[model samples]
Target: MQRVLIVEDDPLIAIDLQHMIHDLGYVTSGIANSFDSAKRLAPHSDLALVDVNLVDGATGPRIGQFLAGEFGISVVMVTANPEVVADGIFGVIGVISKPAQPATIKQVLEFMSTYKHQLVAHPPALRLFTCDRRGPL
Candidate 1:
């Protein structure tokens, strides 16, 4: 099972995400509400669902870059403020608008897991940097 890190500031949301991930058959590596906590949990995670405007301000992009670039983890931005990363960020797969449906989350997790381990070519419906189905690719 793949290990996922939830970088959300809201405790309720984080717990909800943890339960959801667990129910989806994935392991929850940990939850981090700040950059420091993210750094500590990075090595143990294979994928990360990050939120912007975290407890430490709008550092989701930075955290995503750090996790993806430094740790080679697959990062998907899960932020309500999708505009913040509209231009895309280095090392991030893409952004998922907040209040994501369980089906969307499931598809993304499946695509990412397969892509990471098997180098799968297709991406989920989300606006991935490599496979932008909604815009010019």
Candidate 2:
């Protein structure tokens, strides 16, 4: 089972995401409301669902970079602002828009599980950022 970390500020949303992750057969490593907390939990998780805006402001990108660069954890941006992910932030595998459906979440996870090194987008509506070993694809 893949361990996933939820890096969201909203307690309610975090709980919902936790349930969704569990239902999708992924284990919940932990939930972190801030970047510091996320850093502490990064080592234990295989992947992370990061929100662009958190309790510590818009620090999700930084956290994603740290997790992927320092710990080799996969990151999928789950946020209202998909544009942030479109900025071509390093370490982010993909972006899933806010109010994610269960199906979309599952699809994203499956894609990640198969293509761990490449970037992808969920729901097909959002822009996909693909990358290869050399660079963006």
- Taking every candidate in turn, the Cα RMSD to the unseen true structure, in Å, is 3.5, 2.5
Clashes per model (N, Cα, C within 3 A): 0, 0
**CA RMSD (A), model 1:** 3.5
The window of 10 residues in a row where model 2 has the poorest summed lDDT is: 125-134
Model 2, 1-137: lDDT tens digits are 78999999999999999999998889989999898999899889988888989989999988887887888887888888897668656767768888999888888777766675555444473345575222574
Q: Whole-model Cα lDDT per candidate?
A: 0.84, 0.81
Candidate 2 stretches with Cα past 4 Å from truth are: 117-126, 130-134
lDDT of 2 at 133: 23
Q: Which pairs clash inside model 1?
A: none
lDDT of 1 by residue, 1-137 (tens): 78999999999989988888888999989999999999999989998999988888999889998998889888899988888888888778888887887778888888777765465554444677753222334
Q: Which stretches of candidate 1 lie over 4 Å from their true place?
A: 117-125, 130-137
Give the best candidate by lDDT: 1
